[model samples]
Structures are given as C-alpha cells and as structure tokens.
Target chain A: MSLGIAIISLLLLAGKQIEEKFTRNVAGIDMVIGAKGSPLQLILSSIYQIDAPTGNISLAEANRLTRSPLVKSVIPLSMGDSYQGYRIVGTNQQYLDHFQAEFSEGKTFEKVMEIVLGAKVAQNLGLKIGDTFASQHGFDGEGHAHDEVKFKVVGILKNTNSVLDQIMTTPLESVWAVHEAGHHEEEEGKGANALKLLEEDDHHHDEAEHHEEEQEITSMLIKFRNPAMGMMMARSINQNSTLQTATPAIEINRLFALMGFGIDALKLIALVIIIVSGLSVFVSLYNSLKERKYEMALMLSMGASRTKLFILLLLEGLIISVIGFVIGIFLSRLGLWLMSENIEQNFHYDFNVLSLLIEEIWLFCGALLIGLLAAAIPSLGIYNINISKTLADE
Target chain B: MIATQNLTFAYSPSKQFTFPDFDCADRETMLILGKSGKGKTTFLHLMALLLKPTGGNIQINHQEISQLSVAQAADFRAKNVGIVYQKPHFVHALSVMDNLLLANYLGGKNQAKDKAQSLAESLGFAEHLSKKTTQLSQGEQQRVSIARALMNNPSVILADEPTSSLDDDNCLKVIDLLTKQTQEIGASLVVVTHDQRLKEVFEKQVLL
Candidate 1:
C-alpha cells in the first residue's frame, strides 16, 4: 500500500515537472518548420534537441516563410554537429534573445568560428573562455571531426534552467563554412583543385537556385503574430510547400494525453491499494477488540468511559495512517531524486522534488478519512460491551 | 458505604438472578462467597456500576447509582469505585507505573505520580515501576493491580475472585493487601469469590 502511494505520487510529480519543462523550453515559439516528416519528430528535434533533425530544408524556402503575414519572428537553426555528445547549435543572436539568456563570462558569438558555451556544456567539457575545440559532423562525438577550423569558446552562459543550458551556440555561417570547406576538401581529393571552376559553375545557375544549393538549414523556430491563425498557417504550409510545419503545443498535448491514460490507470490502482489497506486495518482492530473484550470490561468497571475507549481505538488507526502517509511521501521524494539523476544524464532534464504541492495535502486528508472510516466501523463495538458478561466469562 | 436492594440481572429470560440485599460501610471489608455460575461477580458488578441492576436500586454513599447514564456511571465509578479483577489485567504495552497512572488518566484527574510511587513502595514493587507489566510475576502483578485500584483513593473497592489462581501464601498476601489498602483510604472493600478458602478471612459474609 505504501509503495503504491509512493509510486503514484512520484509519477504525478515527475509528470508535472516534465510538462512544465517542455512548455518553458517551447516558450513563445508556436511552430516548427522542417523537412517533411512526423510532426512530433520535428517538435522534439527542433524545440528540445533530444532527437535528430528530420531532414534539412533549403534556407531560401525558410526565408520565404518569414515574410508571411502570420509570422512574428523566425530563428533559423543549423544543427548536425556536436562536441563530446553536447549539441553545437548554429543560430543567430536572436536565438539567445528569444530564450532571454544571460552570459556569465566574455561575450556572445560574432565571428564565424567563435562560440558561446552553455553552463552545463562548459562545465561537463571543462571548456573555459578562449579554449578551442573541433566540432564533429553529427550529434554524437564519434562523427567525423572538422579539425581544420577549431572553434574558440568566446563566452560561457549562466545556468538558464532551460534547453539552452545543454548546448553550445554559434553564428550560422560557421556551420556553412565547415560543411562547405569539407565539400571543397572532398573535391580537392579528386584532383579538382580549380576552385575558380566551381565558382564559375555556381554563377552559371540562377541566384535563388545557387543559394538553395549552397545553404541548407535543419529547421526554423517560428513565433506567430496571432496564435489563432497557427493551424491555418500550418495547413497552408503543409499543402503548398515541401517543408512541413508542426505546432509544438498540439504535439506535446497529444503526447501527454497518451501518457495520461497510463497514469490514470496507475492512480486507480493506488486508490484500490489504499482501500485494501484500510480494510486490513479494520480487520486487525476488530480482531484485537474481540480478544480484549474482558480487558475492556475491566477498564469500564475501573471508570474509563466507553467513549474514551472508542476514541482510543480510533486513534490507533489514525496514527497508523498518518505514519504511512508521511513515510509514503518521503519515499516518493527519494524515488524522484533517484529518477532525476538518470533523466538529467539522458535527457538533460531536472526536477525539484523538494517543492511541495497542494495535491499532496489532499492526499493526506484522503488517507485520514480512510483511517477514520475503517476505525469507526469496528470501534462501534465498544458501545455494546457487556461488562458483567465479559468479566464473568473470563 | 455501598449497598444494594433487590438487585436482579438476566442475560436471557432463562438465566435470571435475584441477588439478596447487602451493605458495607466505610473502612469495612465484606466477602460474597459462591460456587462458579452463582452470580457473585454479577452482584459485585452491579455495586460497581459496571452493570446496571435490571429491577432494583444500588446506592453508594446514599446516592442511587442504578439510574445513572452510561457516561455518568463511568464518571461516578472512576471517582468513587476501584475494582481488582480476578486475572489482574494490566495494559501490557505500558510500564508498571504507567498502568497505575492510567487509572488517574481515565478518572480525568491529575496523575499523582508521588501517590503512585508511595503506593508502589507500600505494595512492595517500587523497583518494578519502570518495567513492562508482562515482566512481573503473577503475585507481583496482583500487587501492582492493587496499587492501581488505590491510585484514585476511591470510596469503594471491589475484588472479583482476585486469588482464584494463587497458592495459600500468595492468596492471603493478596487479600491482606486489599484489606489494608482499603482500610488505609477509609474505603469499603467487597471481595466476591468462588474460592472457599477466603471464607475464614472476613467476619462479614454473604453466601450464594
């Protein structure tokens, strides 16, 4: 019974924490536009950085969406690079402004190869201001390294307690420069050292086509001017363009709705366990009261009131429930603490288990009500005690 | 003083008892002797207000107690009556001193620890005050029971076959303690017993 209560409380607390974290990280960004794929995948990859990007979209196509009347602000993101498993995001200074991030040391990135580290990224990688590191081609550290252009850490951000804390940020041109240089190197390996011929080949195409072929971004985080038009804009984009738009709020609520079914079932099971425990308490008290009939008679003869005896037995049940509730709450916090460590390591998520909730107070009152009902049922026997009969029988 | 007139009780219509009238004044000791099932305990319970007489009145210090409500009877008993049962039932969870203090607690009076200590000292189990009641020998437990009955210094003391399981020496010691404690507090003592050995210990007697 105690274990059931603990597990239910932990699930409720962790669920709320995760939901709050998700909403806070999504912030004012109502939509994500990325390559055609699953809407949930786009939201998870673009907003949370917990998944790989669906695919890359042409920067020109993303720029055209920024000119839409329904759009408020658009921040383009170029991902697919990492340093020791921590993602290095290539975005403009607007991304930092969007998250309201503050720097702890040095300044924000302005140069192509200069970068600013989030607090967790800097601490975990032991990177300080002026330290330099090479970026790998993929989100994991095992990918091919861009060692030719070492990125210098120009600043370190203070702990924001948001998704930004788990990544490094740099100017978008750095990602283009690294990938473009890598492409040039591959061409050079084929003995095509004439870079002028490549420039002439680029000039031969239209400017828009050439830009699209040169620059491809992972996704765009967009805020809507009027949120009520979000679905309308998403529908138009999905039908008219190759790029897909996903509303973060809609996808997250769907995920929670699916998770809610499972949580509700577990909560029902916990309630049943509490009821069964109350029944057990009833049985034990009833049995003991039967065994102690003669003793109760003796007390009555000694001038202890029957009501006092009834309250005494009822208090026994109340004490048990109160103790169980306190222990169960403590166990839930301990379980959350243990789970938070694992989540922080895997998803870069943290929960504050020390924060008390009003729901827990209601839980305690519910437990006490069960205790009272269980005890009151059996303690009614006190009024029927036959002092002469019980003592004479003994 | 405690007295009962035409006291009667019945578990069922087939099992009815009509007890003879009796009275014992302050500082007096009386014995009601009977075989098993003769209702000696029933008559004692009536006088102690634990059982209300079905058809007659019981008077303690000239006040009719049979008409009292359940709460009133319990309050009256706690203030004026003390009972020593046959098996010396102490709350096993409590220490010897706590068992004595329970009487004061139930009676809704201030716990008289000094009085409990003196009673324990006089009853010759002062060292056992801090020990659990279950740790005491049967004879010592009975002595502690006697001390508990005297904790509130009641006006009447009732003992229900308190020495039925004791040997001759322990039986006399228990009866002696009951008589001495009641006499010290000027309370009437009534011992209802099936044990015939106690017939010679008191001058006043009623046989069922």
Candidate 2:
C-alpha cells in the first residue's frame, strides 16, 4: 500500500519538476537560428546546450541578423568541444548578463584561451582559477584532444540552478583558435593569428577580411522587440535563407506534449494501486470485526453503546490510513533523493524534493475517505449483536 | 438488592419461557441452577436487562428496570451492574490492569487506578496486572475477569457459568472470590449455571 502511494507521488513530483525546470531554462531567449535541420535540434543544441549542433553557419552571415531593426539583441554560440563531458559554450559577455550569472571568484574571460567555469562544472571537475586543460574535440569526452591550445579557467560562476551551472563559458575566438590548431595542415600561422584576435576585440574590423575567411559559428540566439516582429523575422529567415529558425516556446511545448502521454499512463496505474490499497484496508478491518463480534457484544452489554463501539472500529481504520499516508510521503522523498543523486552524477541536474505539492494533500484525504468507508461498512454489524445470544451460544 | 417477578420471554411463537419469582437482598448471594436447554442464560439476561422481558417487572435497588429504554439500560447497567462470562473474554490487546480499568471507563466513571490495583491485589493477580490477558492461565484469566466485574463497585454482580470451564478446585476458589468480593462491596450476587458441583455451596438456591 505504501509502495503504491510512494510510486504515485514520486511520479507527480518528478513530472512537475521536469516541466518547470525545462521551461525556466528557456528564459530571455525568443528564437534560435542554426544550420538547416530539425528545428527542435537547433533549439535543444543552441538554447539548452544539450544536443549536438546541426552544422555550422558562416559568422559573416549570422552577423547580418544583428543589423535588422526588429531584433533586440543577439548572442552567437560556437560549440564542438567539451571538458570531461561538460559542454564548453563560446559566447560573449552579453550571454553572461542574459543569465544573470555572478562570479563566485575571479572574473570573466578576457584572454583568448581564458575560460569561466559554471559552479557545477568547477565543483565536479575540481578546477580552480588559472588551471589549464586541453579541450576534447566532441561532446562525448572521448574525441581527439586539442593539446596545442589549452584553455585556462579564469573564474567560477555562482550556482544559478539553470543550464549555466553545467557549462564552461569562453570567448568565441577561443573556439576558432582551438579548431584552427586542429586543422594544422591548412596553415600554422592562422591559429596564432586567431589567438591574437582577442586583442583586436572588434570582430568586424574589416568586412572583406571577415567574409574572405571561412570563419563560422554554430548558432545565434535572438530576442525580438515584439512577438509580431519575431514571427515575421522567423518566417523570413526560414524561407529566404539556408538557415533554420526555431521558437523556443513552441518546440519546448511540443516536446512536453510528447512526454505527457507516458506520464499520464503512469499516473493512471498509480491511481489504481491506491484504490487497491484502500480495498486491502477494507478487507483487513472487515475480517478483524468478524473475529471480535463477541468482544463487541460483551462491551455493549457492559454499558458501551453501539455508536461508541462503532466509532472505536472506525478509529482503527483512521489510524491505518494516516500511518500509510505519512510513510508513503516519506518513501517518495527518499526515492526522489536517490534519483537526484544518480541524475546529478550523470546529467548534473538537481531535483528539488523538499517542497510538498498541493495535490498530495488531496491524495491524503482520498486515502482517509477510503479507509473510513471500508471500516464503516463492516462496523455496522455492531448494532445487530445480541448480548444474551452471543454469550449463550458460546 | 435485585428481584424479578412473573418474567416472560418469546423468541418466536413456538419458543417461550416463564420464570419463577426470585429476590436477593443486598450483600446476599443466590445460585439459580438448571440443565442445558432449560433457559438458564435467558433468565440471567432478563435480570441483566440485556433482553427486555415481554411481560414482567424486574426491580434492582427497588427501581423498575425491565421497561427502561435501550440507551438507559446500557447506562444503568454500566453504573449498577457487572458481569462475569463463562469463557473469560477480554480486550486481548490490553494488559490485565487496563482490562480492569475499562469497566470504569465504559461505565462513565473516572478510571480508578488505585481501585484496580487493590482489586488485583485481593484477587491474587496483582503481579500479573501488567501482562497481556492472553499470557495468563485459564484460572488466572477468570480471576482477572472477577476483578474487572468489581472495578465499578456496582450494586449487582452477575456470573453466567463463570466457573463451568474450570476444574473442581478452581471452581470452588472462584465462587469463594465471587461471593466474598460481592459481600465486601455490599452488592447482590447471582450465579446462573448448569454445573451440579455448586449446588451444595450456596445456602440460598433456586431451580430454573
């Protein structure tokens, strides 16, 4: 019975937390533009930093979107490297301001190979300020290493309970420098020149030089001045250009709708289990009342009214239901804590299990009602007991 | 004091009973003897007011009791009468001491722990008061029941085949305790049983 309650409540807590956490992680961003592919993949890779990028788009072309009057601001992301399974996101200071990420120690990245670690990434990897480590080529942490250009951890961001907590942030030129070193066969000095671009700071110093070079970024996250303008821009970008645009709100809602079916099915099974538990409470109390019929009659003849004895029987059921609900809640919390620990180790996600849900209050009341009904049905027998007949028959 | 006159009961048209008149004064003891199928328990139930008499008047302490309502009967019984059954059943979940105090609680009287201890002491089961009733021997359980019946210091004590399940020695010992306790409390005592061994024990006897 407790297991049934535990399973039901745990599923509710987990499903609710997952939906809220995913929605909250999409804060501030309105749309994502990336290489032509599944729009959801673009949103997931760019906004959430969880999936691989579709493919890279030219930096000069992505920069053209910034000149549009409808766009409020843009944050370009350069991906394709990792450090111990945590994604290394290459963007500017605007991205940090967008997330309201604060520094626990040190400061933001200023040099080309300088990086700022998220709180979880720093804690898990035990990387301190000024520590340097070579980035791996892919997201799996098993790809070939870029040993030539080592990135130094310059800062550690405070815990924000967002996707920012599990990533390493660096300047965009650092990605170009690391990959340029990987393509050593093309030209050796290009990697050194990309490293020197950190001092130039003005990425668009020369348009002919920028477009002549095949420099690219994975995606651009954009927020529009108005919802109508965002729709117009998204439609134009998808139809008139080779890049794809995805609305974070729409793609995330579609993802949740797909997941809702499985969650609803589990909830139905949990409901049935709760009902069965109520039935078990009924059966046990019914059988006990049968065995104690003589005792009931004896108390009755000794001046106990039928109503008083009836309440006593109902109290037995009440106590059972109360105890079951309490233990069920405790067990569910324990289960969630264990799940959180496993998820933190692998996915770096934390689940808030301490907060009690309002729905669980209703579940408790339902359990109590079932218990009382089950007990009340059999307790009705107290009125029919004949004192003289029971004593004589025995 | 307890008395019943012209008592009649009918379970159906084919089943009926008429009982002899009887009375026992305060602090006095009476034994009503009969064989099985002779309405021994029915007569006891009539005086206990567990069943309403179809026609008769039962007076306890000179107050007519047979015509009392169901709730009133229960309240009156709780305050004025105590019963000892044949098999010595109890609320098995409680200890011997708690079982004794239950009488006071059900009777709407304050639970007297000191009174329960004293009763246990006199009944020779004081050391076993804290143990579950099921842990005691058959003879010890009967003594506990006797102590329970005296917890409220009622005006009447009814024993329904209380000693039928005991051996000859335990039977005499139980009857001695029952009569002695009733006398000490200044309550009337009545024993209804088919046991022939008790016929020679009581000075005042009636055949049902």
Identify the leading candidate in terms of lDDT: 2
**Which segments of model 1 are wrong by more than 4 Å?**
A144-148, A180-213, A228-233, B18-21, B55-57, B66-69
Candidate 2 Cα errors over 4 Å, as ranges? A185-213
TM-score of chain A of 2: 0.91
Mind listing the fnat for each candidate? Answer: 0.73, 0.85
Tens digit per residue, CA lDDT, model 1, B61-162:
889999999889889999898888888887777899989999999898999999999999999999999999989999999899889989998999998889
Q: Which pairs of residues have clashing backbones in candidate 1?
A: none
lDDT tens digits, residue span A122-231, model 2 = 99999999899999989999998998989999999999888889899999999988986676633444444655555243443764575355578999999888867789
CA shift of A46, model 1, Å? 0.4
Please state the error at residue A267 of candidate 2 in Å. 1.3
Report, for every candidate in turn, its global Cα lDDT versus the true structure.
0.88, 0.89
Model 1's chain B yields a TM-score of 0.98
Give Cα distance to truth, residue B96, candidate 2, Å.
2.2
In angstroms and one decimal each, the interface RMSD of every candidate reads 1.5, 0.9
Q: Per-residue lDDT of B117-176 in model 2, one digit per residue for the tens?
A: 998899899999899999999999999999999989999999999899999999999999
DockQ of each: 0.63, 0.79
